[model samples]
Structure formats: structure tokens, C-alpha cells
Target: MGKEIDSTITFQNLSQKNMSFEQVFQHIITFMKKDPSGNFRLMFGTDSQVFNHYTKFITGIVIQQERKGVWACIRKVTVPRQMLNLHERISYETTLTEEVVSMFTKDHKEQLINIVIPHIYKGANFTIEGHIDIGSGKKNKTRVFVKEMVSRLESIGLKPKIKPESFVASSYANRFTK
Candidate 1:
């Protein structure tokens, strides 16, 4: 077997203790079950902060319960700096989001549960939105790759969110990376 990648995740409201991905998923299910209305959105996003010799990557999951409230979980990892260009950084961020979504969706499919989002008139039981850090603006150099990133996400069947709308990445996760 391949060597495991060491990592830890902490839920903002749950506890500071480290948790595996499975444990995090269980918590999400419990949170969703608490409200029979089932109107909630699960959003995942990732952001990175480059230091002198290393880069810190933060991946955040935000669960919004239709204005009831919000809960978030975050995982952080650090790696030696690679001096990645803007394109590489954006690509890496998207890859991280995709990995987390893939894990959640795979399990969600096996253990099907009906999630009712009142606003969503039709389709799947729930939706996972991927918040990309790249956005269109004069100050943001990452804007150039927004279309490519969005297209990649769409090809994999994930709804993409950018800047202003992608607070999970630009706001929530960005906080911890700092």
C-alpha cells in the first residue's frame, strides 16, 4: 500500500480536536439530520499562503442551513515552497477542492439521503459548490485563468463559485491561511 498523507481537520464549532474525513462526514450528516427541512448547502474551497520557505494550504467546508446558521470545517497542510507561478497556484487550489468533493460525493452516493433545499426546485438531493479563489478584477492576477478553472470544474460536474460569491475560499479559508 502507498504511504498515507498525514493531515488533520478541525471543525470550527464542533471542537479543536483533529478528525479524519470520515468523522467530519458523520458530523455533517448529524447536522443535516437535526433539521427536517433539509435546506442546506455544502460548499468546499481551498486557499494557499506562501511563506519564505513554505506554503500553507487551507481547505474549508461550509455548511449553510438556509439562514438558520453556518458551520465550517478546515484542514491545513504545509509544504516546502516550490515557487509556483500564478497558473500553478490556481491549479493546485482547484485540485484540492476537487479531491475533497470527490471524497464526499463518493460516500454520499453509497449512503443516499434525501436533502431538501427549498429553493432548489429539482435535481439531486444536495449540491456541492466549489469556491475558486481566482476572480476577475484589476488587482487580482489570477483572473486570467478563471475561465479555464471554471471549465475544468464544470467538466467534473461541480458548480464553481468565484471571488465575491466564493467567500468560502476568498474569505473563510483565506483567513486561516494567513
Candidate 2:
């Protein structure tokens, strides 16, 4: 048989545990179905922290309804050794975010978009974004990488967001990295 995705790979939030990606998508669908006319934003972002011997990375997936709240979950991955290099860690974080975004194939995106298509004229919208932990602020060490990393996210069809605007990475995922 062809290689299959590991069942052990799961995303979790406060109320759920060990949920597969498909399960998470179903939850997103159910949430959207409840208010199809609302504008929505699906965002994914990753942040990492280096412990003594290993590095921890957490990626957050958030679905937000404008003027409404959000339903979010996170997936964690660990590297065997600490990653001290700034560029490498940032790149890896972006890669992790890309991997999660890739899971939503064209058809999956279409399904989400369809839910709001009919209400588009009424101001309903569905947008997907990739949040990078780096920023372009002069005082930021990650400033040098802003161009390259943002370009990388753009290549994958995401509206790239960074630093302060990237709360999913800087705030949500960062919280669990510690």
C-alpha cells in the first residue's frame, strides 16, 4: 500500500485531544456552517523555542469570524537538538507553517470558499493567511529575513503577515513553545 499519513499526527485545543487534521477540518466546517454569511479568516503560523537539548515548535491554526471569536488548535513538533541559528529557526518555522497549509488542497479550499461565495455580495469573505514570526522592524534581528521569508509564503499563495500582525505565531503558538 502507499505510504499513509501517521495517525499519531494530531492537533489539539483545550476541549479536544489527539485530533487528526481531517477531524480539525470538520470542526472548522461545522463552525462555519453555523454562520455562513460571516467573513472568515483561516490562518496558520509557527513559533519555536530552544530548550537545553531540544527545540520545540508549535504551529497554530485559527479560524476567525470577523466581529466573532475564533476556534484554534495547535500541532507541536520537536527537533532533537537546539537550533541556535536565527535564520535556520525562522526558516524551519516557516516550513512548518507551509506544511500545514499544504494540507488544505485546492478542493478543501474550494469547499471553504463555497460556504461564503453566495454571500460575497453581502460582504462575506474567506481569506487564508500565513503568519511568519519574523518582522521587518529595524531593531528586530529577523529584519534581514523579512523579504526572503515573506516571498516564500507568497509563493504558496498566502497573504503573508509578520510580527505584531502575526498574532497566531507571535502570540498563540509562542505561548505553547515555552
- Per-model root-mean-square deviation over C-alphas: 3.9, 1.8
Colliding residue pairs in candidate 1: none
Show pairs that collide, candidate 2: none
Query: TM-scores of the models, in the given order?
Result: 0.82, 0.96
lDDT tens readout by residue for model 2, 39-119: 899999999999999999999999999898899999999999989999999999999999888888887899999999999
Report the lDDT of model 1 for residue 48: 94
User: Against the true structure, candidate 2 has what lDDT?
Assistant: 0.93
The alpha-carbon lDDT assigned to residue 166 of candidate 1 equals: 92
lDDT (10s digit) by residue, model 1, range 47-136: 999889988888898877775787688877677985468788889888888777766654463442454544235432456688999889
TM-score, cand. 1: 0.82
Q: Which structure among the candidates has the greatest lDDT?
A: 2
